[model samples]
Target: MSNKDEAITIVSNFLEASMAPDPELAATYMAADVRITFTGGRAMASPQAITDFNSGRYAWVKKALGPFDWTEHEDHTVVYSNGTLYGEWPDGRPFAGNRYLDRFEVRNGRITRMDVWNDSAEWLLTPELNQES
Candidate 1:
């Protein structure tokens, strides 16, 4: 497989491990010095940190993965994963269609950087939007 294909597979596998809440497995796909930033500029030190953050914000969450788009550079590959988030909220309310975009920089078969953005904050601010009307 091409480098790009390998990068995508690495990313997909990481996501699966993450949703499984298997931080140890997820960390396998990342570089030792990986940089991760979540929505609202929250800097994360490790996959465990992500799981901790998610624990406070959501009851349980999973991605409704859409597509993987990538761009190749001289040294690394930039991959973008866009999709909607679906799961239950802290209040035990189920929600879906919360759009999310994740950007990753893969080098040497490991992700060196990851940035995440999502619509959960907006939904939280406007609760009616998530309500079944």
Candidate 2:
């Protein structure tokens, strides 16, 4: 597989494991010292930290996988996955269609860096986003 294809596979596996509620498993797809930046600009030192933060945000959450857009560079492959989120709030309200964009930097088949951006924060700021349907 080309570098871009490999990066896409690696990221797909990582996201699947993460959405399986197994960040520990997801960590296997990452570099030992990977840097992760979550939505709201929180820098997480580890995958477990990201899981912990998500636990507090919603009772349970998972990524609804989407197509992976990959860019191969001279040094690394960058992959962006755009998707929606589905889960329940702490108050037991279900939420879906929370758009997310995740960017990953892969080198030698391991993700070295990940940056996450999602509409969750914007949803929080816009009360209409939480209305019961």
lDDT of 1 by residue, 51-83 (tens): 999999999999999999999999999999999
In model 1, residue pairs whose N, Cα or C atoms come closer than 3 Å (at least 3 residues apart or on different chains), thus clashing, are none
- TM agreement with the true structure for every prediction: 0.97, 0.94
Candidate 2 lDDT for residue 109: 80
Stretches of model 1 off by over 4 angstroms after superposition: 131-133
Top candidate on lDDT is: 1
Clashes within 3 Å, all models in order:
0, 0
Off by over 4 Å in 2: 130-133
Error of 2 at 1 (Å): 1.2
For model 2, which pairs clash? none
**lDDT tens digits by residue: candidate 2, 87-129:** 8888787888888999999988899999999988877678488
